[model samples]
Target: MGNGYLRFAALGDSTTVGLGDPLPGGGWRGWARLLVESLQASYDVSFCNVALSGATAAVVREQQLDQALAHRPDLASLLVGVNDTLRSTWDPDRLHADLDHVAGALVDGGATLLTVRWHDHAALLGLPRVLVRPMAERITRVNEVYDDLHATYGGLRLDLALMPEVTDRTCWSIDRFHPSELGHRALARAWAERLCAAGLDFPLPSLEAGGGREPSWRRDVAWMVTEGAPWFGRRARDLGPWAVRRALAAAR
Candidate 1:
């Protein structure tokens, strides 16, 4: 694997699509790109990212996973489940089953799989105590599935939930949900380190550097109006009704 060119495919949602890490030409250069670049320094690497913003794990399994599998990558990364956590009708058992199917399919097809456990963003975002507890619990359940899957399969797991740096304000974009460019770079470095530790031959670099510049207040305000408000409105419209229904069901 080391001697030949590596084909890499990234799957999942907004994090994999790189929503917060804007590029000069309009698209994003997320952790996937960073990782490929790093690998290209030493080996020939072809990369594909089939992640869509606002995609759920089920959507990834139904839509993106097939496209990724078609690429027949030597390595693949799956970063999902956060969107599922926010859903009102989230079923952990179903999520786990879907995850297992995806992981098994990828590994069975001969790709080295990589996945992540989400950080405790509910707490970091300063949600109300009521909201935070439930959100945290949901995230915990999702991560437990991640742990189990990683244990059963020999995939690399980036335990971002345990990494304190992910919660830092500097690592988040204006939306406060997605990782900033710096955060993405940090994530890429972490992945590289894990791969190297697992015996992939590559030059190890310092992970502390390469933080991207912080956005200015003016840009922040513009984003709030243009991106943030619309995002919030959309979520409310889409998830609000489902949430109400779930609450009613619980009460019954």
Candidate 2:
């Protein structure tokens, strides 16, 4: 595995798409790309990332799963379920079923699957106090799904929730949802470390040195006004009503 060529594919939502950490030439350089670059230092690696912002688990299963499978990747990463957690109609069991299918298929295809437990974003996002517990519960349940799948199939799992640095303000973008550049670097380093610990040898750098440029307040403010506000408005128009209806149904 180490000497041969490697194909890697990443599938998920906004985080995997790297919303906060934009590339100078456009698009994003998320943790998936960083991990791939690290591996590229040694192995002949070809990488593909098919992640979309605002994508739910079902959407990922429907859209990206087939593409990832077609790539016949030797290594695959799945980082979904956050968008599902945000929805009012979220069903952890259903989400788990979809993810189980994805994991099962990739493993059956002989790909080494990798996935991470979601961090508690609600706490850092400054959500209304009333919404925090519910959101936290949803996140916990989703992570349990990841854990269960990993236990059933041999794969690597990183518990980002337990990592305190992930919750720090510096680690997040102005939107408070996506990771900042520094945060992305932290994630990449973590993944590399985890992979190495799991016995896959690769040249990984120290977390402290060569961290990317720090985001400035001016850029942050500009992004909030330009991108964040529009994103919030879209979510309100599209997702809010659907979520409300689902919440109401659940209450009934």
Candidate 3:
């Protein structure tokens, strides 16, 4: 609670950057923004969202962490590592170390850190059979690191893997990774409920989906061509060789 108001910082990757939930005029609005809005009813809040698209754990540690810490947030959320799993550079030890640094810094600074256990993104994305196991293994490792951090830091955590809504196609955009507007609304509601349950003096945000335009097939197709394809190409270039090497070692 610096500057006479509660400060909230959000850090991670595209999801936190609000890529799936487009604003009507232009920009993006995600669950974190919704959560901050909810908090404003009871308390003045200063919110900073430093998450970028396609960022890895190392990226958050090196680039976003300092920005977040500067806000001196009363609460902060960290959700990342899916992009790391997509790259050839994926390393569990390095991922853990980066996360540890980010989490430790926030908690040490007296911020209540929020973490998440990721879902099986490979299954959700319906990735190629050859890539599924490798991706799943990496996601599992990421979740394990989150579990350790939650235990060590004694903060709130959301288990997306166990959330049945996460499996529903309606919760996801066309890409099946980022959540749709309704999905983001639900996530914000859930976080508010958790904070209230943890004895934070704030009312829960409504679970209703509002102010969101329904997604259309035409728009979805356009996004697939313009955004999705290029993103997939970039990931494939890096992830392909690593997957091949893993497959060869398995065959041996």
- CA-lDDT, candidates in order: 0.80, 0.80, 0.87
Candidate 1: clashing pairs of residues: none
Clashing pairs in 2: none
Please provide, for model 3 over 1-252, each residue's C-alpha lDDT reduced to its tens digit, 9 standing for 90 to 100. 444378899999998998778877768888998888888988889899999998999999999999999999889999999999998877899999999999999999889988899888888888787799989999999999999999899788899877878978887899998998877877888888888887666666666766555567898889989999899889888888888888899999
What TM-score, over all chains together, does every model reach? 0.88, 0.88, 0.95
Q: How much lDDT does candidate 1 score?
A: 0.80
Query: What ranges in model 1 sit over 4 Å off?
Result: 204-214, 236-252
Candidate 3 C-alpha error for residue 88, in Å: 0.2
Task: Order the candidates by TM-score, highest first.
Answer: 3, 1, 2
Worst 10 residues of 2 by lDDT: 205-214
lDDT of 2 at 42: 74
